[model samples]
Target: MSERIITPRNRGFLFLDAHPAGCTRLVNDMWRSVAARPAEVLGEDAPVALVIGSSSGYGLAATVAGLARAGIRGVGVSFEKAPTERRTGTAGWYRTAATAELAEQAGREMHFLNGDAFSDAMKDQVADLIEERFGRLDHLIYSVAAPRRTDPETGVTYASALKPIGATARTQTLVFDEDGKPDVREVSTEPADEDEIAQTVAVMGGTDWERWVSHLAGRGLLAQGFSTAALSYIGSPLTADIYRQGTIGAAKAHLERTARTLDARLGELCGGRAVTSVNGAAVTQSSTAIPGIALYTGLLRGVLGGDMVSPVDQLSELWDQLTGVRPLETDEEGRVRLDTWELTDKVQDAVAERWQAATTETITDLADLDWFRGSVRQLYGFSVPGVDYSASVETDVAWPASR
Candidate 1:
């Protein structure tokens, strides 16, 4: 198989290709980055951890990075489907395999489970697997982002559709043109109904987190003083209507509440704890699909000079919080406020200013473009190495196990 060079263009979607070696290189780089800057506080060595939504995006990368940095050997359970030859496993799946392979090479124990995380059978399987293998869990990370969920009580499967809040919401988006500036265009979307909002909350929100925590707690599988965390995001006000205030916002609110409840329950169990980390807006397979986030991220990237932190960096911070080395800011509700730092008041103010000033005549600059490009590149196996981009590439590269 010949390697190919993958680059991002203005098609407005994530360009994906399977590059196992590139994925492995990312894992290696992440390990080096974390080891060079070890956290001041550290958790017990080789503590067990379980990551749901463990196959892609921030969740997958975070799981790999956290395990490598903390020197913890644990089981990873994700609902990632197997990858096709023409395309990479979802970013998370590739990263999971890459991380596990690297960890094994480093003399660390690791395991991967592929299945639906929201299923009761899968949950029981995970608990049983832990009991049969490691006996206890020290950390739990919930990274799943399903758009719809089945109602356990009603036995109805509800899927969510994304749209604006009111009659219609108009927003500016950065559309790349051949000319350097981002073309600002007004975009509008319809509003979702009350049932849709509720369903969205049920699916994408924190109920799964609570279920996992409760399941582990009830089964006595959670270790004493363990730490559990879930990822959340609060973008600028531009996206608040659809994201922070709309269906997703409602879901996040539920998740935030779930975090607090889990924290108290876990505290009672092992003196353990539960936390939620609000992450910055980075290009993920998921985040890109959101209406105005791409423009906001692109604009923020332009403003910030494209030096945004990668999933590995965020994961390091998450690990630091989990191990009690660094203190995480929490609201009255008790969720770790990482997003506030990622999208600082200064940054938000600047973005808002740019958004207001944005017009078709004036687009974003190269600095912002760089940020967007960097994130987009990282989503696929680009920017990481051992990939020979000069040659024609095969999109359908099969995994070793499947092959």
Candidate 2:
């Protein structure tokens, strides 16, 4: 049988050596999304686009929705590594490969460019590729995430830190056990210093998003009525300290501020708009590394009864809203709240009681730990349903011919 490795961590990453079984499951998941919400092309005048971080999570969903539903012919820029004989391919690689295959079947143009989205050269390359293939890009989706970033212009590197805003706080943190179930324990996190806060903002804030917009606009790359959106998260009050009020929160605040500013500028330049969408929490590779979010999400699944909303659902909904079909309802700051349902009083009141009552021993009774573990497992291409895990599998997944 093919093997995997899931190590336990308090606030560390869930590690695993993935098998080909996981890849097939992911491919099925992608198809399942399209099947569930069949894509209806935006129109003959649907915008040509550029999607950053377009291989996984929200980015991948947006790409699928754009091409399959909206008929957006554009380039996808991501920093995913290619798979080798000694290891199975990265999930993003397989997802992108699957996307290319699907796009080819539809006779749509879906080009994949693997590299750093923060670099000037990568930005220029994306612009050039879009010009070469389909000139005048209209839609832009910025969904990139990284632990560290080096400013391409000034050459300043900043690494993000996940710590609470105030004093060191102790709470139940989720980790994966050897049996691949949710393991909870009490852990404390130190507050971020001023420098750490600055660094976090530098890495995760809206500077890069602004840079991309300004560059694209300066070069006359953006189309009239161009629409751009970046993904952000503002969860329930339970995680406010660690997420919304933490360093990441400060960065998001900056991101929202930038979005509003860019929205005005985009209108001035070309009858365009820029807005930030607050997404729902799920067990992504990024969320698993955070301290309290995993346990909270697991408990949330219990509160909502096993039907947790996936990133694809959120992206698909957002796509429908932003395609000029349905008007977007926004706050005074012009931020779209896709997380509204996840934060309703009904959901939060239940989660609040569970959050206070949860412990390592009582957590399983309160939350569906198995589902949480499965969610994390799926991130690393393991624990997915309906794959032949016992059979010998191919390690090499080919890059798409279109790329």
Candidate 3:
């Protein structure tokens, strides 16, 4: 494989020139990052799992890693519009194929479903397929990060905005030039209305999650001890204005709330077993799109080791909880707090103080920048080991027949 050039352009999206061998190497590297530890023993009969949005980003990678770690065979459902004039395959789609192929090589059974996850038709198709193939599903993972969604109740599609709360909010961001200097650039954002917030919540929030659970339960397809989880993030105050305090934040709050309701419902079905995981912040494609968060993540990269727990690690932890190997502890509100250790007062206080000083000071060390860049690269399939960059690659790779 020839060396592939990868660049981050306009937030979390990556512009890549890839080779098949490089892509394979990338997937292998991700698997090695969280290979099972001796302390963790998967059940002899691994449960079948389904991962919606299991084509790219944390969701796709986590789906692969979770299945592998749990020693489970499962299917992944992703929406990648291709062969429709666009003629493009989503990064997740290609990664899903790579992951499935890798799993098969290890003598595991995996399947992929490609379509719009929010569609009722797609959900029905998945439920039917699961009943036909596996007869029952033990776990479901919802890791979608779509910016726009059509409202089922209102019959209108709404797109999420990345601007700030007011008519004009200016914030400083890092602009990486050819020389890789963090040039300070000011960004201004526009405000949104109440309708937009509600609509965005309806689509991007936890409604679809609830519907999936209800549909499966209604059909009597869910197995006992079934576990489902959706990932959420709460960043620093600098990002809170645009993230946790903005329209997206409102949607996440809805997700957090909906988890409780879903937990109660699933508990009745599965004997008091269901969970929601609030994961720690790393450079994910979705996280990068949030205003001012890239800078914050970059700073965190400097403080934490460059190898801040990978999505593979997060997935392994999720599987541990799902398989009853590690019991999940909840907060007072009955939400799974995975990052409670990272979100402690001391950690937040230290990061906040560093962020305040970094804004004014000249912190241009490679060590500091590696904190962010490393995390970002790991989010995508880059900088992983065993990839042969000496050969040529293609960005347009296809998943298996099912995907």
* Best model number under lDDT: 2
- Best of the two (1, 2) by TM-score: 2
TM-score (C-alpha, index-matched) for candidate 2: 0.92
In terms of lDDT, the poorest run of 10 residues in model 3 is: 1-10
Task: Output the better candidate (2/3) by TM-score.
Answer: 2
lDDT of 2 by residue, 151-192 (tens): 997898899999887778676777765555556787888999
lDDT of each: 0.71, 0.78, 0.68
| 162-258 per-residue lDDT for model 1 (tens digits) | 7655557667666555543456687787888887787787788887788888887789888889888888887788788768877778788898888
Candidate 1 runs further than 4 Å off = 1-11, 36-45, 85-88, 151-155, 176-182, 327-329, 383-386, 392-403
After superposition, which runs of candidate 3 have C-alpha atoms over 4 Å from their true positions? 1-13, 16-20, 37-44, 81-88, 152-155, 163-170, 359-361, 374-390, 394-396
> Which residue segments of model 2 deviate by more than 4 Å?
1-13, 35-39, 42-44
lDDT of 3 at 48: 81
Residues 1-403, model 3: lDDT tens digits: 1123344332323533223444466676777666674543344366788888887666866676775677777778888644122223445555667788887776666788887788778878888888887788888888888878765556677786664455556666665655555655567777777777777787678988988888888878788878888877776666677787788878888998888888887778776455567777766667777667777766665666544566667778877777887777777766666666556677667666666666424556412675566445544545545654444445556568752
